[model samples]
Target: METDSPTIPKRTLADLLFILFLRLVAVSCFWFGLQYWAMLVGYSLVGAGRFDLLSLPWKVASTSLAVLFPVASLGLWLTVSWGPVIWVLAAGGQVLMYGLLPDIFGPNKLIILLHLMVAAVYCIFRLLLWLEKRRHRRQVSVDLP
Candidate 1:
């Protein structure tokens, strides 16, 4: 039976670097998740009398994201399609939260912008590889009799 799925093109150096970037992002996602979780736990256990999100809606919203990011990290590590979607969502949520409630969540606007810039750079590199591959394919087709 003919397969509906097309064969994947051979991996190149650029593809490998892209995969490495994804893996690095995955690891960073895991770290960020853990960092948020640790803060929640620390607030609850150590700083209970001083401050915590327990009294605010941020508690629930941030808690939800604290759970989401690491799970997304797994998909990112595997380089699945859903990974980027979830990662972007988590990152956006963090940025919005921190931007609006800087007192509670410590991340500054600059940090979030920097994170996005890094992703933008990765995307630009990936686009160049894709365009190069397409150009090569067109040249090969044109040369064939």
Candidate 2:
């Protein structure tokens, strides 16, 4: 009964959506990484040797995120287990710090708002995925005997 063709694992709609979500996450990570890099380089060039280049806490946080972004991007792109962990560390740090001290980030409210929007959308996606799984399970159970 064996055929020459290899079998592919069946993927449910949730799996497909998850893969798409991961891809989008990786893309956003890369985008933010670039933004961080640009800000650092631009500031460094504009104010070389300046002691107050960035406030000490902001400097430390931004540097940490700048370093973590590439590794996270690769991890996310590959769907590695730690990829999301790294992304959360970076993004969460920014969100937490900005929430604690909005002035340090900027006068503009857009950054904080964008972060909240992304978090909200992610929560919604997770909810949808859970509902999909629950519905599928119920259908399968109903069909059996």
Candidate 3:
């Protein structure tokens, strides 16, 4: 397909690196928030004397998964071909975490809805990037001839 629309250049390696750094910082902040929430939940459970009944290991594992998500997300975002897979995984994880909230006494429909909304936005961002890449490739091929 031949189109005359101007295409933006794909980011340079240096730009990608800078973006990766920023993503890491953002993800770190996210992890911190998750940890804070986990601590709050843990303390509450302890205060209620339900800590023995609740699985501490499961809670820890959940927190670890939450921390792992941002690192994976940053790596995938930095790699052009893997961005979609990472986004899907991240979104699915968010949904699964939200689903688990009932067990933790954190099942709030509003929170789950908000997570879904964020997932939708993340998907939209990926779609825009894919379109931009396609446009850039097409422009490069046209310029060759």
lDDT of 1 by residue, 1-145 (tens): 5544335556778878878988998898898787668767774346552226365656766587788889879988998988888888888787777777677766587858866885796688769888979986998789989
Q: Which stretches of candidate 2 lie over 4 Å from their true place?
A: 1-9, 12-14, 41-52
* Top TM-score model: 1
The number of the candidate with the highest lDDT is: 1
The TM-score of candidate 2 is 0.69
75 Cα displacement, candidate 2 (Å): 3.4
The Cα error of candidate 3 at residue 33, in Å, is 6.3
lDDT of each: 0.76, 0.73, 0.54
Could you tell me which 10 consecutive residues in candidate 2 have the lowest summed lDDT?
43-52
Ranking by lDDT: 1, 2, 3
Ordered by TM-score, highest first, the candidates read 1, 2, 3
3-28: candidate 2 lDDT, tens digit per residue: 43335435667777777877887887
Poorest 10 consecutive residues of model 3 by lDDT? 44-53
Candidate 3 structure quality by residue, lDDT tens digits, 24-141: 5346435644653455356544544233444674455455555555555565545554544554565455456567756754455774685566556555665666777777689879
Clashing pairs in 2: none
